[model samples]
Target: MAEIVLDKVTKRYADGALAVSDVNIEIADGEFVILVGPSGCGKSTTLNMIAGLEDITGGELRIGGVRMNEKAPKDRDIAMVFQSYALYPHMTVRENMAFPLRLAKVDNATVTRKVEEAAAILDLKAHLDRKPANLSGGQRQRVAMGRAIVRSPKAFLMDEPLSNLDAKLRGQMRTSVSRLQKQLGTTTVYVTHDQTEAMTLGDRVVVLRGGLVQQIGAPQFLYDHPANLFVAGFIGAPAMNFLPATLENGSLSTPLGTVALTDRVRRAAEAADAPREVIMGVRPEHFEDASLVDAAALDRGASFDAQVEVLESMGAEKFAYFSVEGGEAHASDLADLAADAGSAGVPDTGSQVVTRLSAASAVAEGQPAKFWFDTDKVQLFDPASGANLTYSAD
Candidate 1:
């Protein structure tokens, strides 16, 4: 295992369009890092640059404390698992896994031992004789992973290896891949547009946008305290509910009602020199049906009644959607995020709120429902710069 570092790395096309710019990431030995962003956000370009498939426009690339900018892909000593299985249809699973070892002229016995070990780790021991044609999609992906494992390289690079599988299989493969990486203790860098994969698989996730690094941190950290409107909106499942608010006298005036900012939030906003008009963010999971919460718990938050536009029952929990009187919050960052998410054409006539409520709640579509959210969990962002205004000093 080895540490991989990108020091102020950049990639610019001949036409002068920057694919990646001033990117820097330090991946520790045996750590699993993921590069995630919307399509064309330069995540794949950054990965290819690390893999030595693309030339760096500037800066240095290092692996195991050695400069590797000029090294060829084969000389990088890293195993890459591509999105496509890239398996030889004619070769059986055992032969496919052993191919890398054979190319290195490893002795037959050693090759056999490595391939067998990898097959067992990937739970493919039963399908050693099966060709790629006879394997399930998940099994084929495991075969590709096994091929990489047999090489026993310094690090592993995977590019959307689970994108081709069905949703259920993708979830299953995520567990398998994470387990395999932990068992082998190999350094890994994964690239994917799927936030769920990025969240569940990596020790740290790198969020990118417009060829720039937006934020880098643990999944929960980024979710709880995003660096900007883009990161806040991009990292969550139902995404965050953004509402335009006016900050004055330690209180915020919003469509829901006036919210008295908590001391922590007030201090952060004051320290950041927050603007008078700010965007307030609340996650879906942070809200609950007001009637279901204890009175003591309700005292810590604010409640508002809204006409539920839609209610989705999700077994353990429920999602209630409502439309506030005010229209959607407007900003350049929001526009860019909408474009990146392929929802640029979707009309935003009103501010839409989605709240996660208890399954036992009595909320129903077209009925007036009371929703309460913790005031301390709210985040404030600068609309123009998209910077988090309520970021804690710590």
Candidate 2:
């Protein structure tokens, strides 16, 4: 296995349009690092650069501590599995898996041993003689993986390898791939636009946008403590709720009402080097019915009132959309809405605040509902800069 490092790396097309800029990251040996972002956000370009498929316009790329700027893909000691499952139509699964070893001129016995080991790991032993056309979509993806596994390269580069499978198959393959990676313990760099895939498959996720690194941390770290509005808005399922609020005295006054800033939240804001009007972000599962919610168990913050505008039943749980009581509601960042939440609208003249509510009780539309967001669960950001104001206790 090898550690991959990109130091101030950049990629610019021949037309001089910058696809990536001063991107620096390090992937440790045996680490599964995921590159996640929206389409056309330079994720694939970054991966291709590491795979030696694209030229680096600036900075250095080091694989196993060796500079690889001018190296060809074949010389990099790496294997790449793409989204399309590029298997040979005429080749049987065994031939496909053994093709790399054959090209390297390995003897027949060694080829058979390696191919059989990979097939056993991937549960493809029964399908070894079958052609790609005869395999199911999920099976074909496994064959693609099996081919990469037999290489035993220094690192593996996978670009959205499961995108072609159906949802159920995708879930199954996700677990399988994660297990296989642990067993092999190879350095891996996976690129994808799906947040679910990034969260489930990565040891550490590198969130990217506009060719810039947003944040790099474990999935839960990014979810619980986002660095900015972009990371906050991009990491979650339903996304964090952002409401306009003003900071006056030691309290944050919003349309929902005034929330007393505890010593912890205040200290964090002071450390961020900003004390201006702020944006309040709350996650969906953070809000519970104030009447029934346990304050002592939560032990961090205050509560607010909301008027229910819409309630969506998601079987096991429910999401409530309601309006805050004060000032008009508007979203300054479109990326937040485009990432997860639907959209912000001026219904009932901006008295509606939409939030995800638990399914423990029935909440009806157009009803005045009392909801409580755990104080510690709230995220604060500078309205001007969109930078998160949470200070890590580190």
Candidate 3:
């Protein structure tokens, strides 16, 4: 396996419309790196550039320390697994996996041995004689993977390889893919728009938006300390709830009421030279039912009474949605987020907030419930630039 690096790489269409800006990423040998974003966010374009499927307009593309801008895709020594399982219906599983080896003019015995080994690894030995039409969606995907594995290329590029499967199968396949990558130790660059996939897989995640690189870090790092409003809104499930608040004298005047900032939060704000008008971001998991909080814990946070609009009890935990008095906070960077959250199927009035509460808490729908959120856990963002004013490297 070899490391792959994109140094200030850019891609502009023939029409001069920039599809990807000056972006840099380094994928170490045997590292699984993920490229993730909303649809049409230049993730695919970036992947294609690395795969030699698209031309690089600026900067350098290197694999194994060699510049590869002008190299044809076949010479890149990388295998790409696409979102669609592009399998040949006429070819059996074994034949499909052996096709690459045959094309390389390897001896028959070596081809057979390689195909058998790949089939064993993918657990497709039993279905070697079966055609693509006879296999399940997951199995077909594995066949595609087996085809790539037999090549034993220097690196692998997977473009949303599991998007076609059902949720349950996707979960199963995710485990399979991770384990397979670990076993092979091939450098991998996977592109996906799903945050769940981005969080679960990859040693490092590169978040992109509007053809620009947002933040690159471990999934939890991005979740805990997003660099900007877009990254904050895009990384987590249920998305981080955002509200407009005014900061003054180490305190915040929010829709939830006046909140006294903790020392850590205050320092972050001061270090950023935080503006009076800032956006407050709190993850759903950060909120708790006030009734369930201990006395010491309650003392450290602020409480507000909210009428639960919808309560979903998930057994171990509960999600409580409330409608705050003020409307949604809008940011140019979060324009897509607001649009997505406000889709027709999901009502996002900009007034709604989601809180995760302990399942034991006594909270019901359409009834007022006291909720508490940790003051130290709050993050402040500049509405104009979408920068996280209250960000701390720690």
Q: How accurate is candidate 1 locally (lDDT)?
A: 0.92
Worst 10 residues of 2 by lDDT: 339-348
Q: Write down the lDDT that model 2 would get.
A: 0.83
TM-scores of the candidates in the order shown: 0.97, 0.92, 0.97
lDDT of 3 by residue, 239-315 (tens): 89899999999899999989999998898889888889999999998899999999999989999999999999999
Better of 2 and 3 by TM-score: 3
**Least accurate 10 contiguous residues by lDDT in model 1:** 325-334
Q: List clashing residue pairs in candidate 2.
A: 255-326, 321-354, 322-352, 322-353, 322-354, 323-352, 323-353
- The true-versus-predicted C-alpha distance at residue 360 of model 1, in Å, is 1.9
What are the RMSD figures for all models against the true structure?
1.2, 2.6, 1.4
How do the residues 172-191 of candidate 2 rate in per-residue lDDT, one tens digit apiece? 99999899999999999999
> Predicted candidate 2: what Cα RMSD to the true structure?
2.6
| RMSD after Cα superposition, model 3 | 1.4
What tens digits encode model 1's per-residue C-alpha lDDT throughout 328-386? 77777788878977889897787888999889999999999888999999999999999
How large an RMSD does model 1 have?
Answer: 1.2
Which regions of candidate 1 deviate over 4 angstroms? none
Question: lDDT scores for all predictions?
Answer: 0.92, 0.83, 0.92
- The per-residue C-alpha lDDT of model 1 at residue 53 equals 95
